[model samples]
Target chain A: MKSLLKKKCHRAGLIVVFAIAVFLGPAHGYAKAETAEAKSECITCHTDVKKLIRLGWKIEKTRPKPGKSAETAGKG
Target chain B: MEPYEKIYVKPSFLKTNHGKIGCEVCHNGDTKDPDWQTAHKGIIKDPTFPDADKTCGECHEDITSTAKNSLHYTLAPFGGVIKARANKKDKRVFEKVCQAKEKHCSACHSSCGQCHVSRPDYVAGGFLAGHLFQEKPCMDTTCASCHGGRVYAEFTGANDEYPADVHHDKEEMTCMDCHTGKEMHADATGVASRFDLPERPRCEKCHPDVVSKKPKTSSHAIHRNKVACQVCHAVANKNCFNCHAGTDKKGLPYFKSNETRMLFKIGLNPNKTKDRPYNYVVLRHPPADPRLFDFYIKDGLSDFNKLPTWKLDTPHNIQRITPQNKTCNNCHGNVSLFLQKNDVTDWEQKANAGVVVPQAKIPKPLKEISPKWKP
Candidate 1:
């Protein structure tokens, strides 16, 4: 029974390690430098996300402002 | 040679009379100078060199006003840079997605020289001429460069398919046809403009016939007591199922199954219901038989054998007639009125059975042809 418990514990530990390696390891090195450089360049040129949306463009993780927001700003 | 002859004698007189200026003062003259041609060429080339907003400004200052207000200029530098970066990122993603078979960045992104210079020859004159004149950048070689053969073909088809009244069909219009300058919210460098504004020539340009058919005959007319045209026609076609039909490759007839049509009728309703006070369906059919289909109420279902099937007489006009109210319960609050009206028993049995049903035929799809009725 003790041997079986040790075996199960070893399998659980292996599963945990495998999960971390599969998920975290690849994400860490996934074009980090290139992505950062490209994003920075985009921000440099476009200045803000709102402009991109107005041009019918979209980037991941950017929330579009309400349609009225732009009109209101124009009035100002 | 006399001193007067040296100063005033013409070239013809040089051989006959005393030589002029000793041939060296003005000409720096070796009578047959070897390097003189090279010196003169350099001066001509220097003046002709192209410089945006400056070289072209010499001839066309007014041209700059249109461009400054144009989306291309408004979103320059910053918008362009962001687009370039995004293009690079997209290229990487495309390379991965297409397994490197397809290239993406160059397809959509115009190169630095492509927009700034002209083709067939990349001389200073070419660059200057392009900037001075209001010509579309080279779409054939530059735009088609990385866009692949399929996209090039589609663009050609789209150009051919565009209606004559469409702004793009007008002389010298371009990809910026619908995407007007005022619509451009982003600065050239990719920053949002200080003001975000709705573009003009909105919806009404293409659908002028529908919007302005009659003074009181519009979808807005039905709910004018409640809503406005901007409330519904604000977005492209306002989610009308028919207008957006065959838009998606998957939903298109090429991939659609018979079962799929039975399960969920695609393109039947171009105008989908939205967050308005009352839900309405906009039915559109060719105006050839204008009197046949009624504009108001749900009288069209009587013409069709099934809910959406109509027989077509001519292949050219495959008219799609959608009724105003689709969901019977939406407005009526019950199905009893719908069943009573649409019932075959309500009419004389033989007349009901022999009702001439309209059919759909497509001689050609939404392709531009010689106008049936001259404008």
Candidate 2:
């Protein structure tokens, strides 16, 4: 009787584990896929903004007097 | 200052409905190409501009349609001022000046994408929260990005001379709390100035009892419609001086402010409408010089004197107790507090003829401005 009861309890524990995995497994996979998608092909390098501005990136580069002040103004 | 990070897309944003719609839906780039250059080919970068009706309007038709005429998008008032300032007599010069205005001034204007999707182009456009189509774009990033120079700076006590506006300092209120979506979208007000907007913020809107009825405070009763609120409430704030507009070597628009300094002055109201019926109002200098667009065409702003350089101003820096409210003499008979003839620049004197107060016009110090209350 004890052995039969033990076998039933073990079977119940297995079912619970399988149920938890069944619930969480797809969610885990979905999260990973979403993360992968987040690293978009667009962001794989070359920003549309950077390419447009790369030729004359004055604000961050030379920091012209007005640019410097405007930047400092924002610091306020 | 990684430029790439400015345009970075976050993982969280990818999970949003907008991101789920995919890039090609709005951006329309060739995603199949492995090379970034090739992939970016045939891309409709920022399809929201000049034709948001086709892109954003597809889903947000009502908003996009009405927003086309909004102050933010058209920047019509500023454009009007630009056009008004130009030499309208010479058609060729006017066209050249307008083209220059387009190159320089137009960049400062807002678009649907600039506000809703990304940071403003004025601040060098970047993705906001990894390009989330935020219902209300973050205030600090979007609105403050443009108004940061004066309005936001003063409101937040970023100026060392001034304290934060009570709303910001105490309540921690962001701009949208008062500005609202209707204000941002600016529903079809057939008016030029924001001051003329019917839905413009009124102090009475929040503090009705303070001004609506005969209040216990005698001063409130005395100054009901005579003095503007900012005259008594606002502290010293920055006023931008000559803003000369020009283009860089690459023909990118830029402006240089010769000076921006803290000032507080009261002047006669320039445009006293029904909403702002006050006879006296706080006047602050805006960045205007008759020669603003001179770089493009000689005397481009030949008609600059049509509008006052020192316009009616409502400074964002508000306080309950300011120096002006301390005593009757602090404002009344305070010649220095008012915009005197000397205060106006030599060239701007003509423009500000209506704004400059004469000695005779100054109000006498009242013996009893407030009988009931000390404050």
Candidate 3:
């Protein structure tokens, strides 16, 4: 009876571990890239996933001031 | 000038790798040399014209060759019809007729840029999305702009008499959904007609049960080999008549067509080609006269009737449950819908050779037949 209880406990522990892996697997797979180069490489192949990075960078360089319209910012 | 005309304002895709390169690289104009007239000098309107290899080939080599060889680019059907109708005896007259068609009808040729970017030239083309590249082509500007007057109109129920195709009306399926990219980039061969193309879209492709040798119902089993699907499914379609040819003030060739009653008629298949062996099929009157080429050369299309004016056609209007499927009596004895002797005039009788069904050949009604009309 003690051996039977041990077996039951082992089975329950296995089920719990399996359930945790199944739930957390996708989150681990989709963990953020470690570097900028890795992120850029991912975007290159999956271009449809997001607006291109170059567009954002250019807007950062040329975009108007926080309180001003682009036309007014250009004139200023 | 509009901000779109300035060139660098493009889609995000164009801002990547080779796309980062400016438009002037392919378009070839004097953007750097800024004398107003000089800036516009040597500018290529369509980089994909004449040879797509110079531009589109840089990225898509496989598609470029297939697209170049396609019927839309070659306009092979028009060329085939011209050759078939031309008088074989007089070489000079045939040459002149071909020249006229090349000058006028050839304006509708499809190119890479036409489908992927701008509209066709005939419809006054410009950049469709303020100069952004479109991955999925716009169906209206790309396909319907060319096919609008007849096929598109019929499919969309632009004609008040008929309802739209069940695929389009209920499911909202577009043309490209069925007509695959392989069909657009056809096998590298010149086909005389759209019917002759090996990859032509068919009802059987989608509705496998409809064409099965052993069908679900008795009527389908009986009619499997004898009748075409369109004969049962198609509704009244716009038929063109009395087409007049004239030259515009700019000396450009133009033609006008007048549409007749919207009706369905089953006639003998004009071309009994291997692909279409059925004796009965839906007939369409393409807007062509015996004297279509008269403006260019007298007696040019003298042998026009050599090829039938009433063509075997599958019109866009299709329904799963048509009136013909209602009962055995609907079509089994409906002689009016079948091409009859009196249907063709004396002048056109020769052209409509096998189309006119003999009164005796029509199937006898199953039971005690009530005579619907006086024969």
The CA lDDT of each predicted structure is: 0.29, 0.78, 0.69
User: Model 2, residue B345: what's the lDDT?
Assistant: 77
**Which scores greater on lDDT, model 1 or model 2?**
2
Candidate 2: where is the Cα deviation over 4 Å? A1-40, A43-76, B248-252, B373-375
User: What ranking emerges by lDDT with the best candidate at the front?
Assistant: 2, 3, 1
**Which residue pairs in model 2 clash with each other?**
none
Taking the true A–B contacts (Cα pairs closer than 8 Å), what share appears in each candidate? 0.00, 0.05, 0.00
Superposed by TM-score, candidate 3 places the C-alpha of residue B116 at a distance from the truth, in angstroms, of 1.0
Question: Which lDDT value does model 2 have at B229?
Answer: 89
Choose 1 or 2, whichever is better by DockQ.
2
Q: Write the per-residue lDDT of candidate 1 for residues B270-363, one digit (tens) a residue.
A: 1123322322222211111111112211222232222222111111111112121232222233222111214323332332232221123101
Q: B194-229, model 3: which lDDT tens digit per residue?
A: 878887798788777766766565566667757888
Which residue runs does candidate 3 get wrong by more than 4 Å?
A: A1-76, B1-13, B16-18, B368-375
Which tens-of-lDDT digit does each residue in B1-375 have in candidate 2? 356556666656656776666677778886556665577788875778866898888888988887887888777787788777778999988998888878767777788989888888777777776677878888788888889878988889999968999999998988888888877776544677878776667788888866866666777877888889898899987888887776666545567777777899899998777778888998878878777677787887789898888878889989989998888888888888999999987888888899899899899877754354643
Q: What tier of docking accuracy does candidate 1 attain?
A: incorrect
Error of 2 at B307 (Å): 0.7
Worst 10 residues of 2 chain A by lDDT: A67-76
Instruction: Point to the candidate with the largest TM-score.
Output: 2
Best by DockQ: 2
Error of 3 at B66 (Å): 1.8
How many clashes in candidate 1? 35
